[model samples]
Target: MSETTALSSLKIEEVPQKLQIKNYFDLKKYPFEHEALFKREKVTSVIGILNEIEPYAKDWLKNKITSAQKSAYKPEASVISEGSYNVILENGAVFKPAAIIGFSGSKDTHTIYIRKGASVIGANIYLNQGDIYVGEGTVIEPGTAIKGPVILGKNNEIRQGAYFRGNIIIGNNCVIKGELKNVLMMNDCQFPHTCYVGDSVLGYCTHFGNQATSANFGIMGGIISKTITLKIDDKNYDLNRNKIGIIMGDYAQVGCNAVSDPGTFLLPYTIVYSLVRIPKGIYGPNVILKNKSFEKGITEVASLKI
Candidate 1:
């Protein structure tokens, strides 16, 4: 089929009703709580709203950061830093043998902000690249590297070996030990162990087992389709984006070592079995997704309670 013909065949509204972002996430929860930008009625896509809000959010945060810089204090003896940064010691923050580098080898001058009661601990923990804001009482453990344009909420536990590439916004009380890039994680989510989550949005209390991966690109690359297209019920919905990972709903859980293809969407409370290679599409609100093998795709599903 001609490219235009194939593209014309795809429609956005054809996306299943169950796959709607509202079904998986509730904006009343963390990160977006009390935000007027999200509460507006006309904006339907949470993903789109998230992107739209980024610049404004960053500016708001930057203003606060600049204000806070007036009271910034020097780091302790063990801490090493370069370029420009600030550490606010309102409730007592700590950095144990950490290095903060504020330049990204370019014109952009990255700034690091460690809020009150936060801790960056490690033999060689590194924070660099773009602007970084670590929330109150958050603990970043050993061997973790956080590149910036990242915002984290209160009391998050970022364990050892965690590597955050960039463009991440995480809410309060998340437990993370993985590689993340361009992702938004709502409150109380747990990605406990090594995993790769890129270009994704994870809803409240979502959990990813060890080694779980949200693949964000097509294996075929740009050779065929430039953007990711989701097929639902044999109909195509062109997302018009090249790098979309999983869009998980509230309380969703993906088992250990499972892989979710690009543009995967899981509704609330969905549970995926271990070792399953979930096909790129929408699935359940309360169901168990199981696969006999990666090549076989999803072969079985059962109703789940909670």
Candidate 2:
């Protein structure tokens, strides 16, 4: 497809500056072609095409407000008792130790007290001194380290030897394994391998292939910053979190060994094929590669027009 043809089909009035970063990535080095396409196609039609490949995009956005609310809600201090410990940082902030840990095996006997509705395989599962809250129906494989103040939702499978850190919130039906450092995940996500997921928030149903990782700092070990602007209720807003890794929308798949640079924001349903390096941007649903002419791939399946 010619650039002009692709541009004529998309219907965007103007490409937001934040969404224009796709030009910097190797896969999408052509900006003028993408911008022109944006003018031709309507956003709804484009979203429809992406939805076919990633059905969970709309669901993820729909639940954002609820997730935000849950994050904002604070548990009462009075509700915490002696068996439940609190870790107070030097900044004077307090965190409940139990909410952050998950244990399995004979370790349960060592637990001073298990919180209400906390699940375990049996008394055979041991729990260290960390504060851990095992959500209803959550399962911890043998030999998993249950850190303090870890809040896990229902039906999570924490694999063996998985090391968890505090300030982590895992939503329902997620699978985690192999050295999950401080991270927060929404519902239905999976990190099922030896991947290092540290200081990140994963949207619902987002899947990470084996060894897919994201960097949080620059070469000098200094913090990296990137600006992200999203349209909310037709108004654009900026999320100013410096330590951000990647804000992937629902049903977005990160291929194996793919390394997303720090602060990468992938729109809903975008798929990164294996070994592909995506520069920052709002990548349209599909892309076509032809004889040095890169164009938007057809949204419809089996549309022989391309």
Candidate 3:
């Protein structure tokens, strides 16, 4: 599909009149590569916004890198190699491969491919047991169970005891901590603690606070439904994906013990306070939280807090 058509399919929405594009820009750097692929015409403006955001935008920008990969064609080398240590993409990208060791289950049953420079240590780790592809430069620590059709991009560190199932695509420079489950992390993201991130897509450089979690299902226990889209200027771009978790813009952070409701959209540079239970779209760069009045068991206080 054409770029414009793709963007249009995302159902672009206009920013609130009270909000400024510069504010959004200042909060998070747009993913230039994804912009080039999906919104090239506006890339110049997006880059301008990045310049305006400066140093703070790096993490946000990195998170966007994965989106670019989504639109790019996968090279043949990545598709057919087995147990190869090095993967040379058609574009001449080079990566080191590692060995898949220590599996108690049937090796033939699981098809695990470790690109060059990637390493998987520890025993009882299941691979391709269900269709798993660990990309170049990735490291899977011991005690990890990776279910199939999962794509782990370059330079990712999967810590021990992490159980990831389903269709997960992890991008570059990410760190997956133990005790974490079913998460689709985009580029450069990190979840380094007991975080339950299920059925979600995390943007680049977004970090989850320890114990931070998101609820991806309803009380009835069916698949959670969320709408995916892009917001440019004042338009909403619609992406026709039925299962979506959170569309966190770059550099968004969820504090420890924070719980995000399903279908939440956290704009870049947004910070969720610790132990906060936030609804969808409650997070934005310039959001101000203030307590106007408070009542306590022994006292009452009125305060304006940011």
Candidate number of the best TM-score = 1
Per-prediction tally of clashes: 0, 32, 25
Alpha-carbon RMSD of each model: 3.8, 14.7, 11.1
Candidate lDDT (C-alpha), each: 0.73, 0.46, 0.50
Off by over 4 Å in 2: 1-130, 223-242, 280-306
Best by lDDT: 1
Could you tell me which 10 consecutive residues in candidate 3 have the lowest summed lDDT? Answer: 45-54
Model 1: residues with Cα > 4 Å off, grouped in runs: 1-19, 29-31, 34-43, 49-57, 72-80, 104-108, 123-128, 222-225, 293-295
Query: What lDDT is reached at residue 210 by model 1?
Result: 93
Identify the superior model by lDDT, candidate 1 or candidate 3: 1
Q: Write the per-residue lDDT of candidate 3 for residues 198-297, one digit (tens) a residue.
A: 6554666888878887775544435545544444454454433333355465677778887776556666666776766765443565342222234322
Q: How far is candidate 3 from the true structure (C-alpha RMSD, Å)?
A: 11.1
- TM for every model, in the order presented, reads 0.83, 0.50, 0.56
Candidate 2 structure quality by residue, lDDT tens digits, 20-97: 323222223211111222223333222222112112222222233233222222334532222222221212222332
Please give, for residues 1-306, the per-residue lDDT of candidate 1 as tens digits.
Answer: 423223323233533565455667777554454245444443345444435435544665677577774455665676676765544444577756477765545564545667789987772433454577788999988888887777888999999899988777888999999999888788899998999998888888999999999999889876776877666556665566688888898889999999999888888888999988888878888999998665554457789975
Candidate 3 whole-model C-alpha lDDT, 0 to 1:
0.50
Ranking by TM-score: 1, 3, 2
Residue pair clashes in candidate 1:
none
